[model samples]
Target: MTDDVQAVHQPSDLRTVIMTGASSGIGAKAAATLAEGGAHVVVVGRNTARTKEVASRIGGTAHVADFDRLDEVRDLAQRLLDENPRIDVLANNAGGLVSHRSETTDGFERTLQSNHLAPFLLTRLLLPRIVESAGRVVSTSSTANLFGRVRLDDLNWRKRPWAGGWLAYGTSKLLTNMFISQLAARSPIQAYAFHPGFVSTSFGSDSASMRVLNTLTGGSYGISADAGAVPLATLSGPTTVGVPSGTYFDQLKPYGRQAPQAKDRILAEVVWETSSRLVSIPSDL
Candidate 1:
């Protein structure tokens, strides 16, 4: 495992898992599987009714969080801290693609903020709990990461004209990969990010064009939501899956060919630094 020049944290049994985007799609399916496997699953969704319904079905705690709102994410984190003293896995699975670029009230690009910033904040805020339990952080990433182009000068996409959602979404996933890699390198906590393939879920619902694209291409080729969920669940804990920490996966197999930026230590540091500033946290933490 030359790719894994860095050592990994000690593995432990997984008992409780907190998963976002559990209202539907891969998140929802993973929730069911984890619960059945005897892990206490925490379900976070954007919609209230759907979240509760899924929680009820899985017998897991439910929290509503619109990733576009940083405050909501903070609140969710605090609530989880109060209830769950120790979490085994923090699966950052909540994210989407919008046809056009938008900004959150926090004044950041919606896609990046939702997909990357919110999860980074939650993970940082919950670092103590994760360390106490020696838990792993598994994020839902994508193969689009190979083509990611993030502008360190303009992460908000304010100066860069809206070039459509594909690039923005890819950049977000790339950042996720970098975030996981940096965290693995700097800390003893275990972390992994994965690509779930072209899952047949309402992934890009916010965009009309995405919906049309899904309708056209998804029907014949898209994998079922259940199929996509398997990778996250496999990586959740007790993995015979064999992918090392700080590594990205194409579905189940460890992929050595990563975007050059994803493996750049300097870029990873930059992403982490910028994320710390944006999340209103001290970098020293």
Candidate 2:
């Protein structure tokens, strides 16, 4: 984070917030909270029926997009920009943990692409609009970051046999914070990243490896889905609430702790430059 980037606290107007992964868990709960407060919510999720149901419940806009496909992400960005003249908040919440190491059709690691690259590209594409609206971008990260480390050279783990599935998931979360750190340094948009703790949701039920890991670790014993949502909801609340830009939160605490590297300027630059290259955006452009 840079000193040039300052927090612009605005009055709490009827904010138009866009929350991804709104079909379930924390995203869905955040959408409900914002909408109940008279703000217009745009609910995004991979599932068609559930997303529509959630949108219907809050009278919000629902859009289906699979982050595994970059094409869908691009289309989503286009639709949001075209339909909504102003976007007050963007929640980069849709992500997953793959049980096995794999790459998307885009040739990027599944967990890394879904959790980090997709949101990076989305924020870059919508940055101008976000600046115009003086909006905030709240990203959902994880407390599993304690077990995470970033490998700039082997970001996708294509060169190593030691890369496990959980490693990829953890690295993605760490990378998200690094991305947010630099993003705040270079831009004036109010942005925040948070760890929602271990929420009790069927987040990785599809994977046998993940299921076994969850059982052994009692991953389902954490707080409820709604409890994990408070941090995000608080950060996304009216600017009058007073949260510093580029800060990482542990649950609802504004100045919460993060892995040291997540806040490293040198590492943040490397991650930002590497990400821009991966997305084909020149750093100096």
lDDT per residue for candidate 2 within 85-139, as digits (tens), equals 7788899999977877888888998998999999998888888888889888889
- Give the top-scoring candidate (TM-score): 1
lDDT of 1 by residue, 1-285 (tens): 001111112224547788999989999999999999888888888887888888889878777888888888888887777777687899999988866888889999888999999999999988888889888999999988888887899898778666568888888999999999987887778888999988877777777766687778855557999899999988885555565678888888887457788878897898899899999997665
The candidate that achieves the highest lDDT relative to the unseen native structure: 1
Q: How many backbone clashes does candidate 2 have?
A: 0
Error of 2 at 129 (Å): 0.4
RMSD versus native structure for model 2 = 6.6
> Where in model 1 is the C-alpha error above 4 Å?
1-14
